[model samples]
Target: MSAYRGVRIADFTQGVAGPMACMLLGDFEAEIVKVEPPGGDRLKDHPGYSAWNRNKTVVTLDLSVPADLAQAKDLARAADIAVFDHPPGDLEALGLDAASLRDGAPHLIHVWMPPYGTCGRWSRMPPRHSLLAAISGIAFRQGAHGDSPIHLILPIGWYGQAVMAAGAMGAALYERGASGQGQAVTVSGLHGVSEVGGVVMVLDQPRLPRGAPQGASPSYRLYQCGDGEWFFLATLFMPFFRKAIDALGLGAHWEVLVLNPALALDVLEEVFRSQPRRHWLGLLADAGVPCAPVGNRTDWFAGDAVRHAGLRLEFDDPVRGPLAMPGPPARLSATPASVRSLPTAGPLPAWGPPQPRTIGPGASRPLEGVRVLDMGSVIAGALAGAVLANLGAEVIKIESPEGDPFRSDGGPFLTCNRGKRGLGIDLKQPGAKEMFFDLVRQSDVVLDNYRFGVRKRLGVDYEALRQINPRIISCSVNAYGDAGPRAPLPGFDPLLQAEGGMMAAQGGDAEPVLHTIAVNDVATAGVVAFGIISALNARRRTGEGQEVITSLLAQSLTFQLGEVVTWEGRPPAPSGGIDCVGLSPAHRYYECQDGWLAVAAETVAEAEALLTVLGTQADPTDALTAPPEGPLAGRLAATLAGRPRAAALDALEAAGVPCAPCVRGYEAYDDPWLAENDVFVAWRHPRLGEAVGVRSYADFDRTPGGFRHPVPDAGEHTRQVLAEFGLAPERIEALLAAGAVFEPAAARSHLRDGGAALFTQ
Candidate 1:
């Protein structure tokens, strides 16, 4: 996009989250100076390193050396942003912590990413993504049917945190343009875990039973066809569910199907198994039911949809030969993102004072005074608005008179709609449409996930909104991009998992398996939020807003960034299988005397230490690379099979190997360390009573954000929100009387007394 063309970033981070964050910034044409050790990043041996480190200048400098350290400080002083992923106190010891570096560079935005958090009990632990996932109870939650934890091959939290941190960086940059100053921010593995687990990491909420290994429900899971191929059926909404049943000629059994879904699965299964995958997919698509065939990353990467969507990028890297991978996850119309080039060799750039811009309005948080109209429903779009609200924006969620259908999904609704005030209005009603247009004129951004053509039908699409307020930034989240074979179709997270190879990868050689975590949905939220913030920053510079688009399909590819790339000599990327345990012997979950423990030994040194602790005689180099079912895993498993979880964890930690117990249930949120850091917050909901959810995704030292209020019930704040927007009480009452706007409590009588007929007419 070149939105950040003149901005320079000093990237001192390594591994997944830090490198991915810097890569996203680089994609926007920021000048990234990647500072590595004499050898390279710790992840240099990994396959995705090339993709994550693209569009940057590489320079080697050891901070332990006084001369090199001085040069690093000089580069940090000159850059607009400096990112780090060093251990808790390592940077402070080297005089490169935020305070140390920012003392001389007041305009530099310093971002520090820790494995756990800056002040948690595990703060000193190594930056191991798998271990973090294990300790946080995420892995345990992934176990289908309440079995032992499944070690996820994907670093879900890291990627989620990366996108969140990128957004935070953008917000800080925007704020700096006003205050002529910078701030320190933190996006840790804990934040990443919370980002993905927001829907489940709740206090007092009854735990949902882990579903079948294949899928969660009949209308929202994978199914096998006559030809032995599989596809996901995602009739998540009522209308889609009805279409699916009617298409299957099961309309007569609708009542029974809805009341006893488990029993209906048998009938549906028989019907689906009677046909081939192609037959079902075609039949379902014609009926408007969201479905997709199970496919691997290779097939998806080479698909026509990816090509038509302009999501496939092919380039010949000087080091990696010919390569193909997915492009950036979002589309900004005016400042469209692009893949410029690979990392180039260069020396550190010298420092100079940053140019100053005229000061703008100041606030307690980066986006304190910004107003947003959240016209989104469900996870992807709704969570994007929640993120902005958490960042200090005043977000008002606008729903139809009937309210968001997802509100019935209590936990997910609470998670995604937190921090937003709610208003229920009938946009199809002329009076309501005028009231919304008034909101558009006063709002900085409007977010939605209505299908490609639905927004236009409602007269609230980007073009429609721009006409009302030229400065209104429209952020739309869709299943696919704006133009593609799949763009017109409906989609859900599991459908993408089936279509984009996640199910295939997780299933290994067996039937396609659905990963319990909502990886695509959650990641898309972070990605869309980042795009919105970036677009806002661009607007600040150009004095105009633009359309920013993201999709579940794009995020599906993004979640597999490291593995999706194809090159002539690329090594096989790590993947999970039927076991769902892990990718390799050195980086999987092992059963102990009491419980399961996740171990991560990425380096030969760490592998050697792991073997030493297990008292196993094996070559660490060979053992680390052995297949999950190989002799090395067998030996480690045999030894660990007798050791207590705590003792093994202690020995592994003492020996410098990263490991953690697979915590179960919501107990991890109550950990003293997590509680001390306020990883979870508590508030009272209007209908659900007491509630808890993860805190904001990142920590900004000066402009920090936290839980402001509970999720609003439909129209809960209609009167108050309108008053704040300058609407008088009498006008609001007239709108309510006209049935244009509504409050559930106040409208209950009216609706009961035939006001509901207004919708039917």
Candidate 2:
């Protein structure tokens, strides 16, 4: 059985964030019914929809219309939890505010995916992936200083937010089972990205010179091999480097180069250039230096390692033939995630009428009765919990008395917080801490991403809560690890890009640059969420839950460890920049009138093929002996200046030389081959209209997968939520008057059968 088989979700979402949350749930076998506007969710056409929107069903209703609103309320009423995206005030207008929803469905798990959230100054400010990246400082950090507009690394930043949102939803679902009462969980992408970039933000003493190359260390740099292929070498530790040197028979040079690191690098580069990449790879493997050839998208899918890892899966789709899709990264021994089927094309999948039930007998799901409380302030926390919720855990989101901060970040929030419940609680109130503790006592996990020590001051610290429930698993995520020197510093993704080595490494030898995508945030969230799930699995066997902690700083540093560990204790070296054209006759990027193609050959046979293509034969030994200096580069540049890109690529490919067009950003979206592979899907939306693009990253077999909803308006579930929480009409009035809660105007007309009266408690 899947981990989340039979799990039920009340999906209130639109956009990427919340839908992503539900997607994870769907992947694990949770029954997720996406509630949408009478028109539909907006992201049906988001680039790569086929990859993102998988394993789910969809339904639409005009929440602004009274009858539809009532139906939405009924849906929430019948669900174990409901997830939504909206600021606090908007909930009242939408008729699906947290107070109303929780009042009606006390046992529901609520998740709110939003932008700046409900309370902060920027809470209501509109946002998108670009705006978030720009405001967080990531945009400024990407690319060469004077290069094209700063944009994120294609789709990666948005996907990061989606992953975090999914994890948060999962956690909330896990917590709901024990509390017997739903709670509100929230996540923000801006904050999530910030946490992921924490390490660079926390540096007490800057070590490297500003604008230095990221891989300045000799042990962790890319080199061109004899056959023209590029390969990375990362011997991060001195011991590793020593091993490599000995294995390469360069011990005498290494001993003599103790005084100058540049000399060492030059010698090493020369030695590496002596052999083809493949030959060096074999030797390096025996030497224990971690290295890999720079791979393109085509290479990634076809590579042996990726294939062996089962990172790619094939599924049959009605519209497309066998579809190739990426698969989830985490692998469990017993209850693994599966891809049953590709997402169906057209309007959202038709969902059956709502049904209510306490429990059903079946083979156990991984998180059969786990309960979670998610109070994530940003993307990382939200996504971490969402993954758990999807695996059959009951998760409840605890919003601030004001509301979640992400309510204003636009579609991202809706995309991240689908399929859970929401509850607003004023932690500052006299009894609020007590209420929180009560909820914690009933929950198996409590997930948060507040700055270090915030939970302690707020009386939600794990030490204090463990006394109330020793088996409670607490996961705290932050920008920096708890004990680091910069642990207390606040950070966002862009700042981390400058601080972490990513920005420097990504832009080649240009200015230190950041990836347009929020890699740090997304990667950290994934790692942290994975850690939390692992802990939960261990707890199952031990009946003892422990704390799982991670930080953006730790994750980013881990990702860049190849550079960090190698550069540690080593002084920077003056750049020994490679003369690509001069280094090898067959290594070059040829420019056609319309485009460019990179061609590489690393063996004598391959070189011979290149010579045949060029219709020239110089002495092999003489060509190899040419000085790697200016004249060679100039001559090569002239030789391949105006060849047609396609023809050149075809010739190289036919000759067994590796060659490909270097595509960036939107151009990748237009690639017909990608379309042929069914990597993108088309979906119709009510508000933003039609969208056609890439889907989720991976594919699963044996379960539902694909886009189901557009991004949702804020608090789309207010009225129905309150009704399910059992709020009485008169009492709800008093609470609203007391400023305890609200629902959006759109949702207000949907209240049915005097269900608004249960919120007085």
Candidate 3:
């Protein structure tokens, strides 16, 4: 049985974020009642809309009218959750706000996706996905390098918001099973966008630097081959660098190039260009170095690997003919996720009580009875642990005696390792293997994000651990997936961005830019968490355990789902998005007197309305479907430039045209909306006192998630963890004396305040 089989959602969201979140719930077998506006939800046939809106029953309602408003309120009263992207007062004006809903339906989870969250000053200001990206400083770091800003042609910010919302909703659903209550949940485009870039997005009072125009190191950047095709390298650290040099067969220039990265690019470029892309790929693959061929949308969408991996879904719709959408990113062994017919209404699969199993006792969180042993490193692995912790799993993070290599990475580490007890033990030590196995025996699951072969080489692979505890589920994450030709090669987030065509699709004919944010890593982390949940659910159906796997490749595909495709004879259709200068003047960025802003007219009616606002006689179709740069684009830009951002926004919004100003940099947190829900809060840290941190983007009725303790110092819980695991005090002391494990100077003060049991139902 799916986790949310009997749950029902009242979906009033029209655009990307809310619909996407509800769609994910639908995948988990939740029933969705999607209430669109009278004309139907916008972007109806658009790939993103169509794909996400699957498994939903759509109905139209005009909340502005008394009758329709009453109808929406009725749905809200009956639903387990209500989702909407309406501004702060829209529902209240219609007498259906959270406060009103609480009065009538306190058990309903009211999810609101405000632009900046319910912060102070800018809560009411509108936002488009590009505007969110711009405010995140992504566009500036993505290409313009701070002098000017450019928008990413994709709706990443909006998509990320949806993922965060879905995660929160899942946790809330679990909590509701115990509490029989629901609370208001909030996710802002601004908060979601910042989190997608957590590696660079600081959680302290001050922020980190955004981007370097030229990459910090040539070895880690793009290199073009003889065919003028760029292939990314896997040279993030010393081991990877050694492997890369061995594969390239480079000699004397290694030292000079490694020390002097400014001079490395020209030398490496000339070296790479000596061979065709395929030759280098072959060499890298053979030597266990990560590299991939750069291609256009056609090249990526038509790849054999994607089809084999079930990342592609094809269905013959009666009205829309053949339809293909990116399939669900995670795969489960027992009760798999399926794409159901939109019109079908039937009883969900029969789900009985789960088979009993042993697990550690937990505090008042959703996964209270679950115990997880986290042997993960870096962004993807560490983040998966954090997500699990949010659900009330007792996560014991096992690191080396020297600590996780990424502990000093600052912001990323702080963001991904918060809700866990830390134990530092050297896996290379004599008794380390037995100690790890003992923990595994007690754990319900063990998770890691090491390279493809590391676990096997260390004798801690699934096959080895399952021998000790037959009911243990092991989840592993890697660069390329499990069993591929390129599986052995290591992967980094930026490298995947380059290999996945994000740069090419982003830059077009211009110089390709690397997104400074670690989007793929963070996104993949969420998918991993989802996989763990699915596996746990599967265990309920069958008294067994299994290995679950996900990869960066899967997330990259999911991220660019709607925009990427292969069309016959179109030569992959340039690089970026729909040709906005010619075909979508109203859907691209435009400059006002003071700054740039994003606007979109996805439908003909909206285009016509925008044309009316511009007072242009030119047919809207000409601008919307032109083959070359349209005159209407210039006209719109000119008209927009004459007005200030506020006036232009006000005018466009009055006409019902979607638009927002391009906001960026530290100004990101200035919006007042976040204060309303504590979306971005400052939790006290013992070391970094009063450091900034974000609460889970979700707010629950019961068992709401927050920092149980400050981020732990190395080995913060070593003694406590050993004692809890039934290890003798003398044995622990001996190990500590032998330097096999690390013991901190003192127990964390934060942990002294009840630690993992901070939130109770």
Candidate 4:
């Protein structure tokens, strides 16, 4: 049985963020009932909905109707946790909000995901994924130059933020078990993007005019291979740089370039262009510089390493015969992650009456009521602990005596540490080591992201922790792997971004660029979290736990391995510019009188059909045809540009081409197709008024449905949580007096208004 075999989740989510939280929960064996409105979730019509909405039970509710709203409340009351997305005040307006649900079910765990946070200036803004990407500067950052405005291929910022929400919800679930009371977790896509992009934001201060570019050094950059493919080479450290140069037989130019980075990059680029990618890759691998090939989605799943690692999962789906999906990334020697089955489509299956299980105080739960001591400096380890906590693990966060550096004056720290108990432990203090070991004895996992050996110096290393709890899972995250020479170097998301060639890839040939969202950090967090879960699963079978480790540098390197390997042996080539038209003449976007439409012709037959609509030659190979010099390129561009976007789209689709209009973020809310599919729902908010939200990507057939609360206020459950933890009034006061814990002052005002209470315990 899965560790979370009996857990129940009431998912009241719309769109990717809240649904992803539930998706992770379902993966761990939670009984998740996804609640939707009578129309259903908006994601059912989304391009990628099938991939995200799986392994879930779906139910429909009409919150605007009093009878249906009452039923939703009852469902929440019976659930262990509820996940939802709403603006600041929607929950209160619905009367099925967090406070009401918690009042009915004191032990319920509530998760709320929103764009921006519930309290921010943009909290009430009706922004979709792309809009969030635009507002957070992610879209703008991907422009050719720093000041330009070019959107990226996808809404990566929102995706990363969604994962953060998933981790936060998990942590909150774990905490609810400890105190026997539910707490509210509020997550914001904007804040999540901001946190990931914090380094760039900080460096952009007026005083630091030359704010750090995504690439601070040339060692981390991309080079064009002989086959016209892109290869990412990340040799950030001097030794790796030396090795790469030596492997490439560029010794003569090395000394001059090494001393002057600008000169070195120029020389290396010239040398790299001299050969095709494969030739250089073989040479570089033998010499030891971390490298990879830049690959498209198709190349990603087909790559050798991915297949060898078993990262692609094929499952039987009721709607689609053989569905192929990305497998869980983390690997364990014992109990590895596996794909159960593809998600079912349509309505959810019916579950029988609720079966509630009760446990007295101190009785162990699955994970044997394990405790996790989180000491990670940033979000990665903190998020991992949160995942474990969702599975009934108790995670205690040990912050610096001064406070967590990530607090960013309370925003980030509060967001990441929602469900975990917080204690200020000054490891630098004289007796702090003893207190730590005592805590370790009670913990099943000790997680941190400090520089590789820093824990040993602090006396909290795996060996030391094992002395206290022999079966403890000690997991460490770093910029690079723990034992490599570069392991000692200080690094973070941005640094890894540069070193892993993400910046170069994002920049293309223009200049290094940093994504507004921290892709490396969030992706690494997911990888690490998977590692921790896999290790825990192993312990169940082996009667032992072991160390699970990961690094931003390693994850980043692996992420680009496909492209990097492709660039080896190839010398650099001059820019021939993007062949956007060549990518797909039939598959390209066409402008009509109304708007733009994206047409995809994946097959030769489809390509021919699209060409017929354009009244052009119906040849699939037409895309490969080159334009005559001068006015020909301009003429074709004008012809396509002159067409009405809608008419062109209609003609193309009528001919059996896969086509859809490119709807901007805000416009997506009003799309008829999406509305027909029940992708967007309008809910009234008490404070923010009316709001429209997206639905989860996955849809299950057997569970209760929908989100339970709107976004929560900061530290929204302090007093109630403390009381549940069995702390006497005096003790609570004492701790408050010592500055050991705190609750937001606004929580009191909300309580008086019968608003949801916010707290940090």
lDDT of each: 0.81, 0.51, 0.67, 0.53
Candidate topping TM-score:
1
lDDT of 1 by residue, 344-463 (tens): 778776647677655555568888878989988777888888998888888898888677767653466678888889888887665998999998899899999998889889889999
The sequence of per-residue lDDT tens digits that candidate 4 reaches over residues 1-761 is 44355668878877666675566556656777888887777655442444455567777888998988887877777777777787878988987677777774656667677754455333454445434543443333332323222334334545555565555454444443444555665556754553343221111112112212323346655676666655656664556778788777777778777779788767777877878878877787667677765543334445543454344566655554555555443433334334464444345434444444353353233233566777765566665554444344566666663344344322233334433664554566454566456556666778898877898898887778777887888888876656545566555565455444555555455444544344666567655655675566546546676777667754553333223322223222111112121123543444445554455465677767765666565346654233212233343345656788767756765777665555433344465544543444554333334444433212222111222232223333445545654657886566555544455542221111010011000
Query: What TM-score does prediction 2 earn?
Result: 0.49
Q: Which numbered prediction scores highest in lDDT against the true structure?
A: 1
Q: Judge candidate 3 at residue 141 and give its lDDT.
A: 43
Look at candidate 2 and tell me the lDDT of residue 591. 50
Looking at model 3, residue 308 earns an lDDT score of 56
Give the Cα error of residue 59 in candidate 3, in Å: 3.8
lDDT of 3 at 539: 68
Off by over 4 Å in 4: 119-121, 140-143, 200-216, 250-255, 331-338, 345-444, 447-468, 476-518, 526-761
Q: In terms of TM-score, which candidate is stronger, 1 or 3?
A: 1
List TM-scores for all candidates, in order: 0.95, 0.49, 0.83, 0.58
On residues 539-631, what C-alpha lDDT tens digit does candidate 2 reach at each position? 544566677666665544333321232211333311112212213455444455566444444456766676666565554443344442345
lDDT of 3 by residue, 364-389 (tens): 65566678889887778888888778
Q: What's the true lDDT of residue 315 in model 1?
A: 88
How far in Å is the alpha carbon of 389 misplaced in model 4?
14
